[model samples]
Target: MVAFLDEGGMVDFTIEYELTPDEVGRALHRGLKLQLRAVRLAVPTILAVSGITCLLVDAIGLGVGMLAGAVLFPFVLAWSARRLAKRQLTYLCVPTTLRFTDDGYEYRTDQSATTMRWPLFGRVVSTPEFWLLFVGKQCSAFLPRRAFTSEQQAELDGFFAARQKAGAL
Candidate 1:
């Protein structure tokens, strides 16, 4: 057994689980969707409109390129983001255990262990399936939601909400 306590003397959430390639892929896909939502929408809109403008002006070469970019950029980006999951998940050669508390989080695997403070993370974003911890604009860690029981999920939600309210996150 292990005890994880905050300064307020509350025990936090503990999670242990292995991530399948598919889950990793889905999480990565969702993370990218979150990060790129505006870009994805705006880029294609601009490209398509520009493509139409160029075509109307009889700039065939530029129009084709713009049209192609409009059609291909988002698809290629989405595909690359999905493929990135397979490569990134290879580091988890074994299941991992994670403990969350007000101070920070501790991560442990068969070969490695580390702890990081919550402030080191710029934001925490939860998808339907996972929690993504972002450092800068990149996602540095993902915790599978399935690892948490309903009570633990509530604990985690409260933890982050409190942190956000405190302006610590």
Candidate 2:
């Protein structure tokens, strides 16, 4: 179980979990959706255009193939992303702990620790299963919803909302 503490003027929490390949895959997919909206849309649009162009050129089989490929693009993309995420996870499968505080957040593993100020996070994205903190165009960390109790989740949500309102995110 995770723990939340209030000390001085700061509210903090500590989370420890073994990083899993499936989790990594989900994170990658979420990051892609959040950061590459145009690219995602363009791939299908380009494929559809190729399909139409092939039909105009009287290449029935090629047009059908392009159309079919467009239809299957999402599945193919997800499969490839999962494969890539799994490969990347091989080096990241470590027991990790994250500490969230009013000033910033800290990430720790057996070998090293790193901290970043709250302003460094560019955005906060909440999915049903995880809250992804993005730094620049990539996700820096993801906190699973299951790690927090309902009350704690509410507190965390409120904290983020307040930060967003202040233009801190």
Candidate 3:
């Protein structure tokens, strides 16, 4: 998968990348499980904290209610947001192909293919939503979980581990 920009920031190439069904299925399962866990953990904590705060604060019982509501609202919204984000991240429909070559990996997006060597990546991180390959503090690649399989996920883990070993990302 190579996604790049020209001097003018115009997209050069983009495509619906491919991945095996098994890989996509595994990634989706993992992403779903993680998001569910997050929702469960957050919901109880929000309720517990708010309940305590409301009981302890005589002047701001309303504040506690509002705080809890605010948190819970997002949890509700996250149900859909997580679903969409997971689909994009996991590449369930179309996986972005990334080729690891000597110069670095090439990733093709909808409009362009960009190449970045390992040395250019300053850090790498993963969440239930994305596999982030950072170029620096402000620049990065956001690969969705929906776009990869279990094997690919393992491959990415190894890639990042190698980067850490080399003191790159």
Which candidate gets the maximum TM-score versus the true structure? 1
- Pick out the ten consecutive residues of candidate 1 with the lowest summed lDDT: 1-10
lDDT of 1 at 79: 85
> lDDT tens string, model 3, 1-97?
3344457643233334565555444444444444456665676677667767776776377657756775676567556645655565443345455
Instruction: Report the lDDT tens digits of candidate 1 across residue range 1-169.
Output: 2334567768576768887888888888887887778888999899999999999999999999999999998889988997787788766636988887778889898878999998998889866788888887777777887888766777777777777788797
* TM of each candidate vs. truth: 0.86, 0.82, 0.45
Q: In candidate 1, which residue ranges exceed 4 Å CA deviation? A: 1-8
lDDT of each: 0.81, 0.80, 0.58
Count: clashes, candidate 1: 0
Clashes of each: 0, 0, 31
Q: How would you order the candidates by TM-score, starting with the best?
A: 1, 2, 3
* Candidate 2 lDDT, 1-169, residue by residue in tens: 5666666645688877776777777877887777777767888889889999999999989999999988898888778778878787855568878788888878888877889888988888888778888888887777777667787688788888889789898
Query: At residue 72, what lDDT does model 3 achieve?
Result: 72
User: Any runs in candidate 2 off by more than 4 Å, and if so which?
Assistant: 1-9, 59-62
Q: What's the lDDT for residue 32 in model 1?
A: 80
User: C-alpha displacement of 140 in model 1, angstroms?
Assistant: 2.4
Clashing pairs in 1: none
